[model samples]
Target: MKPKYITLIIITFGLLLGISLLGKNQVSLQGNKELPPSQRKLWSDSSHRQIYPRTIQLIPQIQATKPWKIVFVSKDGLKGHQFHHPGNCRNSSWCSIWENAKQFGDSAGVKIELAYVHQNCAGIDECISTQVRLIDDLIAQDNIDGMIVGPRDSNLLVPVIEKAISNKIPVVIIDTPLNTTKTLTQVLVSDRKLGEEIGNWVVQQLKGEGKVLIINGPKNQYNASERKKGILSGLQTGNITILDIEETDWTKPEAKAIAKKWLKQFSDIDAIITVSGNLALGVLEEIKAQKREGILITSFDNYPEVKNAIVTGDISTTADSGLNSQGSLAVKVLVEYLENNQSFPSIVYAPKLELLTAEQLIQFHGSQKSKVKNQK
Candidate 1:
């Protein structure tokens, strides 16, 4: 017999064994009440492992016959590592996505290979070309079975992703979305909603009338565009005047430079809204260096340094985009499709964005410490 048939037989036997064990154990998988409505339908199979929902059932019974190779293409590789570390995954959407995807891949018997377009690319055009070339090469080589991509430019990646789909490889878009609808699923957070909430907070802080500066990510990114729209919508409810809107590469240095220039130009800026945690930190650094006060800084992504700044009252608030959930679910969705030919919703929104403040973090930490003391 052929290797493929033999592998199928092995997987079939494992499922049978899992079913038998289930009969004996009667294990039940409980749905997490905290999960968003879209992902609340959790289920378990014979092995009693909880799997993501929106499946036809008997999903856990399906086993991969071979180690499915999946490639995760991130827009930023090295620069992302500088902020998103394993130890501080909670503070980074990228790190959380990477770690959660790896963990899920291990459990589902899939091999996830990490790739990036920003590895050595000199500029935006080069990065786009590099990403296109990399995905084309992977498809041409016929090595990877699935792809999970956090695209830098939503439009630029559509054709390459379409080509991958035509070649029959499953693709999952995460973090940022692609413009096309050909991918298996896109796992993401509502960037607009997060921005709106932050904008509302700013309105409240400045009493519905103040000058605010918007520090946004690259205009090419879908998330950045959505966030700008949301922020504008939220700010419209108030008498807030947008002092200036600056675009950056979502890096600290660029944000810092912009903040420095803005501080000099606009002396009475009331609030500063940044699209990323690093940008917020950069703004905070510049504010402190200049001994500026009462700016009411807000940012997206709950980075550890940002959290610390919040505690110090240097930053007002930040939103958590549920990066870990997005990462894990992206892997789960892709693996399910690859293993059992399961169908999923075209877009799977991650758990809702969480707005974080210093007061909330302090209370949470106090509760956690109390729990530890009680346990001891």
Candidate 2:
């Protein structure tokens, strides 16, 4: 199989535009009646310079007075009990935000109540049917002032978000933010930068030549597209051949089915690159099963399975997006907005990711050595 080192390079600099896949075509806004055009990125000229939105205006801090009531809606579950977390949250860092928010609320004299959307972040249909019901209950019966939506849920819950905004309920989009217009402040990772990171990593790994396959995330998340741009842009300088790129809905089983199809179509493929943890897991299994050990497998997020795969030499590399940091930052911005009447940029790109090895994952999670190297 392709080594983890190669995967790391592709992710780190994959989206360095003008050099790889991203800059080949401009990512522009086209007027579509169904969807409104959101804020464009605020570009800055400097090496790794800060990229904040042009609309952001600095305002003075507000003294914490009344308790800030915050609600949490996550897609995760503990077994069939459901509605807890782990399933929908993928047991990702986003889940920890609940705890952090609770603690912060308590310390700052804020009241917080989290609404578990479901066992996992399944998509709009499931969220509307399940999580939306929970939100209605919270608004009608529960005692929270506002809500901190789980990442990627913003775009999925646009209509609902609009309703909340209309109700004067502050909604902050956590990780996987989409449709910043309806949100108070969208806080999450800089997918474009993450993509660039991947691109650079991939080029260095191939020494500039290979057939690479890019995997997209859930059917509608904005992060997936941006990450792709970064990956392609970063690969600009390298002689990388893209075999194909497909979306996997971020589901492992779905990814497996797609992998089987791809393996059959491109048996001689050189690498499989993805931005979803579950998708990467599925691809890794297919590669191992087919005995195509020469194929490189890489991806994003801090999912345990993906991290363990890297440790045991199954996955190439994955990055830590500080899942909890997503909620924390948005909370800071939202609290500031409510009190100071200051509005941050419509979109806020998160901090860069940290590279983690299998060993590091195990260490971070306090798992056993065997677990770190476990193979499915």
Quantify all predictions' global Cα lDDT against the true fold: 0.77, 0.63
The reply for model 1, stretches above 4 Å from the true place, is 1-39, 42-66, 82-85, 88-92, 371-376
Model 1 agreement with the true structure over 1-376: per-residue lDDT tens digits: 9999999999999999999988643322222223345535554311112434332222433346779999887666566655555566544457656776777777778898777654766656677788888888889888888998888778888899999999988899988878887899787778899888888888888887999999998875678888888899889889999989999877888889999999999889889999888889889989989999888888887656777888788899987776666666777778788777877566776555668888888887787789889999
| Weakest 10 consecutive residues of candidate 2 by summed lDDT | 28-37
Please tell me which predicted candidate would have the highest lDDT against the true structure.
1
Candidate 2 lDDT, 126-206, residue by residue in tens:
644666666666666545566777643545567666777778888777766656486777666777877787887778878
Tell me how many residue pairs clash in candidate 2.
61
TM-score of 2: 0.67
Runs off by more than 4 Å, candidate 2: 1-67, 75-93, 96-109, 119-137, 151-156, 178-182, 335-343, 354-376
Error of 1 at 72 (Å): 1.3
Question: Judged by TM-score, which candidate is best?
Answer: 1
